[model samples]
Target: MFLQNNEIRDLLNQVADLLEIRDDNPFRVRAYREAARVIEQMTEPVASLVKANKDLSQYRGIGRDLAAKIREIVETGGLEQLRRLRQELPVSLLDLMQVPSLGPKKTAQLYKHLGVASLEDLERAARRGQIADLSGFGEKSQQHIIESLGRVKKSGEKRLLWSDAAVHARALEEYLMDIEGVRRVRVAGSFRRGEETVGDLDVLVTCGRDREKDVMEAFVSFEGVKNILSHGKTKSSVILRPGLQVDLRIVAQVSYGAALHYFTGSRAHNIAVRKLAQDKGYKINEYGVYQGEKRVAGKTEKEVYASVGLTYIPPELRENMGEIQAAADNRLPALLKRSDIRGDLHCHTRRTDGHGSLEEMAHGAIAMGYQYLAVTEHSQKVAMAGGLNEKQVLQYMKKIDAINEKFSGFRLLKGMEVDILADGRLDLADSVLAQLDLVVCSVHYQQRMDEKKQTERIIRAMDNPYCHILGHPTARLINTRDPMEIDLEKIILAAKDRGVILELNAQPDRLDLPSSYCKMAAESGVRIAVSTDAHSVENLELMENGIAAARRGWLTRNDVVNTRSLSELLRLLRRP
Candidate 1:
């Protein structure tokens, strides 16, 4: 199998985690972790680069040694080093480390002292009060472990994040398009709907009748296929490495649109549309819309919608959430697009945990045609990210001024992603915050407060006059960490009242301010800032994902604060 960059990145990260568990040299572990990050953020596939004989060492964290390792994985589809590491470590330790609060050290301790080798064993130990007797794990830790085990058990089949899924989807699409007689190919289902996570891929294709068998054969024989679940002349299902299932279906050209519609569905949306078709005395199926056995509309999605007395609806809005009514009323929003974004409000630099320098980041924004960019580095509260102290922030402001002076048309706004302390205090003083162009307040710690306290903490933070935006409002990492306990409605109402722009953080894992909440905030007259929260120059591209999320929420260009020009955005921000 041709290894995708993500697969290699995952293998490298697993190697690093295992190394940490084995108490290897910290720098060696960091080397693997950094290489993984470099691969993860690369816009180009490492395999292609390797095929072209490009110098991988030019990448941020990849040195000559790491470059060789990457090539080995790309060419061979496996890393002998990682395989050996796996052989040495208990494989279950990896799963155990995924539990919240269970770091590599703790995992190692559990393995060494208590012989806790797997989640099941750990659960048993915790239930029997054996975990509490361990060297570092007390009764409270045991309870926390038990709670986390329940969460892990509940989080069933892993779903790929949209960004991760896009890589695989595009690769498969390209792979299938190369077949001789394939007419059209589309990836349907929640992925097509731009959902945050997708359970599997539904690939729909149109091909000549004679080519159907050939297409199915080619699909199941693809390089990435791990196992064939089922095979047929027109339909085939296969499981890829890492356990993502893909189902491929071949349809006639005439039934392509109908099949696409049927496959690209939220069950509710499909049911509603089918009922509408039935009410109009037409039978709709994956093949076509039939009027008493005579084919009517099926060749195109537009015709399918036209048959139902409605204009075509974009796939992102196909959640059956009043979209049909909105379509009938001609009230479907002109959703925000990537080109509509004029600036980025939340980004980081090397002064914090970010990899890029201020100049590199500014150049990246300029390349994207952004009129302005905000350098919102972490505040002192997040010291692990090398957050700046008061003096450091002032000095950084001087540096930004220098850079701003260097550029004629572009502007760099001095901003800080300040921490909202547990007691509802800003990490930086008002005097310090008042000096900046903007402040993006967020909760970095104390995420487990009771609902009232968490809500109140956020509300108080929003109430601060200098707080212009709320960064990653819920602090949820998709499929991993659950959103903190808080009344989001109360927080949204407070943001509306305070004129605090809610952020749709564009980082793939932290696509916070989910589509549904974005809709609520939009309806409440709260504007959203779809900022990348970018840590590197490459990460600025994540804005597209943010725009996708906004479109899914039915937000228009006017609903996004950064879609406005500099002066207009500043005016919005300055409103007290």
Candidate 2:
């Protein structure tokens, strides 16, 4: 019955969604939403606080009422208010909100106007040309809905982002590790490979044969399990309530490594490895490596790889993408680690839409051992985020200087996340931009431009002498928004020529300059910056996601700009 942070956060988010659909007080809805964000970003589990009878109101956005509700949820595993809201509203209504471009207000409109209560209902209305007649939804919006529905249907089972999958994976791992006789547990497959999205979780455990029943029983009876698909002595499958399928298999210690390798495969990688094993007169399978019916290697992944005549390949690089050859040649680049990062180049504060103030953000960065942190507030073009104008930015510069004067060792880089307008002009004046430590330019609007124009627009923005980095190059929000159409190869080449760093935005949703592009940039000799475009101090932790993406791209520490010391980084940022 233990509730993890994600579970508690999800419950709060559900409450917020229901409140929004009910058209309840905006403040109340926002309170729930804010509380959800706070809990989601918190490093500690709220359940522990409840267990200690500590007041949750000490945290931001959690008031007395919300704190009491959190305590209630932690104690009882349910909220009466959320239960009542569920009763009042059809659960399918919440599903509609998942459709791209369908907010609660628009969903309410569709419901009232066309009786659209589900994705199916909305799809029918869009196809029948009924949604366009609604107040806010136009013909284009209707078409978008239809197209989005098609994507949803095509995507099959919903996939969770790595960040989300990690939560469930860790929770299940913890649960299984606590069971008796469990010797070893590992979450394999794409989750272990560090893929951005995961469709299902594959858990492998090594334990005594007698403990198989106990393990299977415990797994199927997990607190978050919504349905048990199958149960057997050695294998079991269950669907967690969050719509993620988890398959657990109990294996013998002797075959644990082989099973791990087999389950952690990108099919292509496994096939190549098997072919290599066959060439050496050895057979590789889930059970073990066999040479003339004798088990030669299996107890360790390194043993399996050695039997195949290659060094052990890290899971992240086991994609059969030249990794075998690289391993054979002993030319694999050292992958970047979380410890390699020295600073974050792009972050926000209360100066813009960020939740925390400059001081709070700076101290948070200091805690992370960052020698420098950039204050990259949005430019004036992004009005929705309360972006700053030239005059305002100048005033903010003075404040940054004052803050910098307070510390001798730590440096707060003066920077702005300037917008690259439709015509590719920088949002802030060059005079204003030149005065800062660095500039992070991005496209905030007009993302639907054609490939040529979009590529040219970005390239032109990079042409600016003051532009240091391109923020969220694709401007994608995973599962919600598609990346802008652009000639990425041309942009990468342009970035290489212009000395502009491509940002691997660490905002879980927008891990832009994605692995593929990051690889391209690195191969072309363009150093990338893995930055957390964090709005809150808590969000600074997202740097881990950026580093994961970088590793997936096969980037070395030398390929990242922020991995350098402050002086080295400053030299790199300086224009020729």
Worst 10 residues of 1 by lDDT: 476-485
- CA lDDT of each candidate? 0.90, 0.90
Alpha-carbon lDDT of model 2: 0.90
For model 2, the run of ten residues with the poorest summed lDDT: 97-106
Tens digit of per-residue lDDT, candidate 1, span 1-576: 578878998899888989999999999999999899888888887899999999999977899999999999998888898889889988889888657778788888888888999999899889999889988778878998899888788867677889888888998999999999888999999999999988899999988888888898899898888999999988899998868899999888898888999999988998899899999999989999999999999899888888998888999999899999988788889988888999999999878988899999999999999999999999999987889999999999999999898998899999999999998889998999999999999999988777899999999998899999999998988765668888989999998888899999998888889999999999999999999999899999999899889999999998999998888988999847
Per-model TM-score, in order, reads: 0.94, 0.93
User: Candidate 1, clashing residue pairs?
Assistant: none
Question: What TM-score quantifies how close candidate 2 is to the native fold?
Answer: 0.93
In model 1, which runs have C-alpha deviations exceeding 4 angstroms? 97-103, 129-151
